[model samples]
Target: MQKSKSFAKYADAEAFRAAMEDDVRRGRYHDPHQESRLFADVAVEWLHGKLDLKASTRSRYERELRVYVNPKWGAVPLRAITRNGIQQWVEGLTTGDYPAELPDGRSPRPLRPRSIRNIVKVVMGGVLEYAHDQRWIVENPIEKVTTPRSWIRTTTRCI
Candidate 1:
């Protein structure tokens, strides 16, 4: 496929071309077209590819995607997802600070740390990892996201 970009200066254009060539040579080049695909589209594609998952596991993943991950990221392009954005989303999930209206028309309640972590891991992480594997992104941004820690307190027994 033919791709072209116009730079303000000849030197800038040459530098970009050289970098593209170097990336190609190193087998690190990603197709720009794939980067523009919406997260929802990619997530569906990823989910459909999980033929080995049990029925219950697939159902859970679908519910998580529909309820948690998609509301925040569905329309976003693959190239637009960032580590910082994912971190903020995690914080919101823990703090009950997400949008008041979900696609299902219910208010979102704050989730427990473990639930939040599961959503991040099994939903966002899974889809983004698939995107990375498909060369839609240079790297998986979810790798750097930090989930809220679940603090457990133990009471001491006095004899």
Candidate 2:
């Protein structure tokens, strides 16, 4: 198959072509067309493909996808989900910086670090990892994302 891309600078175009050739040689090339799939679609597919998850676990995964992941990433194409974007999303969760209206029609609120981590792990991790496995993306952006510390230790114990 042949693909064409336009770059404003010839050097940039050459660099991109060189990278593509190297990726192809190393068997790391991913078809650009697959990256257009929506995140919600991929997440649903990934969740459904897990046959061994406990009922409760599956329920939680679904909830996380609906409440957290989907609201932010549902309509976005897989190629647009970058590590920086994931990092910003995580920061927003911690800071209550989301839009006023979420999918469930409730106002956004800051989530605890532990809760944020679980959402990232169970929802983001599962979906992005699946995308990588499907060759929809060249790499899992979540691998580079870091969540905030879950909690701070208290210096003194309660009496």
- Maximum-lDDT candidate: 1
For all candidates, the clash counts are 0, 0
Q: Write the per-residue lDDT of candidate 2 for residues 1-159, one digit (tens) a residue.
A: 347778999999999999989998988998889999999999989998999999998998888888778888999999899999999999999899864335556778898988889999657898999999888899999998999886678797789
The local distance difference test score of model 1 is: 0.88
Worst 10 residues of 2 by lDDT: 98-107
Residue-by-residue lDDT tens digits, candidate 1, 89-152: 9889988887533655677889998889889977889999999888889999999788888899
Off by over 4 Å in 1: 6-15, 100-105, 151-159
**Backbone clash total, candidate 1:** 0
CA RMSD of all predictions: 3.3, 4.7
lDDT of each: 0.88, 0.87
